[model samples]
Target: MMNIKNYKEVSSLWIEYKSGLKYYILKKIKNEDLADELSHEVLMKIYKSCCSGNEIKNIRSWMYQIAHNTVIDHLKKENKFADEVTEILGVDKNNTYEDVEEFVEPLIKLLPEKYSAPLILSDIKGINQIEVSKKMNLSLTATKSRIQRARKLLKEKIIECSNLEINAKGNPISIEIKADCEPLQKNSRKNN
Candidate 1:
């Protein structure tokens, strides 16, 4: 339970940080309404954690970390929701991308960090390649090359581990796991 002093502190902190937090989220999300909503959510999370009696050593850092994670969670959920809507509406006939993504996600983890990190930031998280290059501290050319190589490696791994049925458009229609494919089996088990 929050004591009077702690409650006052939390309220004061909210007043001090709300606008800054909202701006931080807006920069990442590019939406005013969502930034306001997520900022309020951050305040509530701070209040709850404070009420639960966790001693936060650095309140500012903790608050910003929460705000950062909230933005990331929103982005991921937004992407997934769009995909779900597309599937539900039958807007895209080539909806097998999501199905393939399920199998590919684990395979990405098996890749080397250098290769996988670039691929994940650019492709999975949907960050712009230039932004990914900046984040990864790599030249744009290097980032693009790594992404291309990662795709090739992922394609090879998929082919090695499963038999993919392709349609006339060269899209994968179905994937059948090969017998005794230990890497994928282990990855699947680990994920589960």
Candidate 2:
């Protein structure tokens, strides 16, 4: 167990994991400013828990779990649940998709703008499809079509770039990125 009673220890922990925690939150929310704020909130939660004498068996995992839960709560508040993506990918909601969620934003970024814009506006931004259509100055049908095409393209890209392990119910249990996956590599580089 780690002792976090000392302020220096907690500060060191935050300094070490701050960037990684913000990146993790950014991947889920696709917003840099919000990710930073949420990461700070996560740090406070961790400090409070540790100060309360909680025994954290694995500090890294425990910190990330708090970060993940914080991101989920933020998404819930923004009405941006991953339900649409889960439905598009045929993944069961009951099975946690935390393993796969990190790849989603990168995959979406790999799509062509014609296909990706509608998806970003509607899905990631949590705007209604009708509002997205108007914002993009496209007919509702056209916006919907683009979003659907984007989903199909994203699914195909995921399959081409990774080896997915699916459960008996056809939900992706895990994903292993292929060694030569250039799109994901480029996306990661762009972010850095």
Candidate 3:
């Protein structure tokens, strides 16, 4: 059982995990403002539960379970419950790589805008480099360079955040986030 007694420790955990939590919320709700609001609520709920002398066995899973329930409640309130259920049922569970991509997209959102913007436009959105260059108002060469740099930086961040082992080709061999590893920090990625 893990007990966090110090307020500072709690705040530090919040700082560390805020982005991942918000991303999880955003995945469920698909609304930025609502995700932010629900994330704050999740944080407050966790803090209160911890402070109330409850013994949390696995904090990360517990927090996510809470987040999941919160989303279900939100969906019910919005009367979108059936839609979400149908969507989930329609999804193919065998596409594990797609599952990882779903988790990874939110982590990518944590990267600094310069790196993230080009990466998102090029990789996630499937936009051509030339188009991304124009949208970013950078020369084609500079945009391509930034996109490459962003991929490198993003790969490093994913490895660091998840404590995953990478192959010679820089592909992750392990996708699980280590319990000891800190949850991903929010958009505080340094300027590169």
Candidate 4:
């Protein structure tokens, strides 16, 4: 636990808070160094906000709100160079060696944009649900629904991807997932 009263404790809490933030960002961003940089950006802003004499009511939530903005800011910055992100998204920019990037790229494609936004923002970026709601400009309940839908989609996609990988391996895994996703499969690949 961290308190506002103790500077060292606050700083320690800041570091811990940041690791989780970085995890979230890394999941969606799919780049460790980029995610770490974004996490640092959020924490630095929080520190500066404190130094600027803004009264934070709930330190944890307040920090997350800032994290949300940092993510939004990062997105906005990316948006300024729209062609770049679009290209980045479409490409398999897996530098060095990591299966996570290869696997996640396909999974990301399976998710709907709206559902993906909240899901990625909350689950991947480690932003709080409330902060995600705010970022998506959705009511909290709506955000919950989007997240649930995203999970459903992600589960379905992963299972599908797994089956594909297995089938490729000439393994004898049951093909039940294909039958289960029959209706979803019709439009699953279509980006809505």
Best by lDDT: 2
Each prediction's TM-score versus the true structure: 0.49, 0.48, 0.43, 0.37
How does each model score on lDDT?
Answer: 0.72, 0.74, 0.68, 0.60
Task: Supply candidate 2's per-residue lDDT for 145.
Answer: 91
lDDT of 3 by residue, 1-192 (tens): 567776676788788778887877776567899999999888877777656665555455556656655666777787776967556323222222333464566677767898889999999999999999999999999999988988888877676766443335543333455454344433223211
lDDT of 1: 0.72
Better candidate by TM-score, 1 or 2: 1
Ranking by lDDT: 2, 1, 3, 4
Worst 10 residues of 1 by lDDT: 86-95
Which candidate ranks first by TM-score, i.e. highest?
A: 1
Superposed Cα deviation of residue 190, candidate 2 (Å) = 9.9
Candidate 1 vs candidate 3: the lDDT winner is 1
Q: Between which residue pairs do clashes occur in model 2? A: none
Question: What's the residue-level lDDT of 112 in candidate 3?
Answer: 86
Runs in model 3 with CA error above 4 Å?
86-192
* Residue-by-residue lDDT tens digits, candidate 1, 25-95: 77666679988899988888777776665544445555676776576577677775756543333412223
lDDT of 2 at 14: 91
How do all the candidates rank in terms of TM-score, highest first? 1, 2, 3, 4
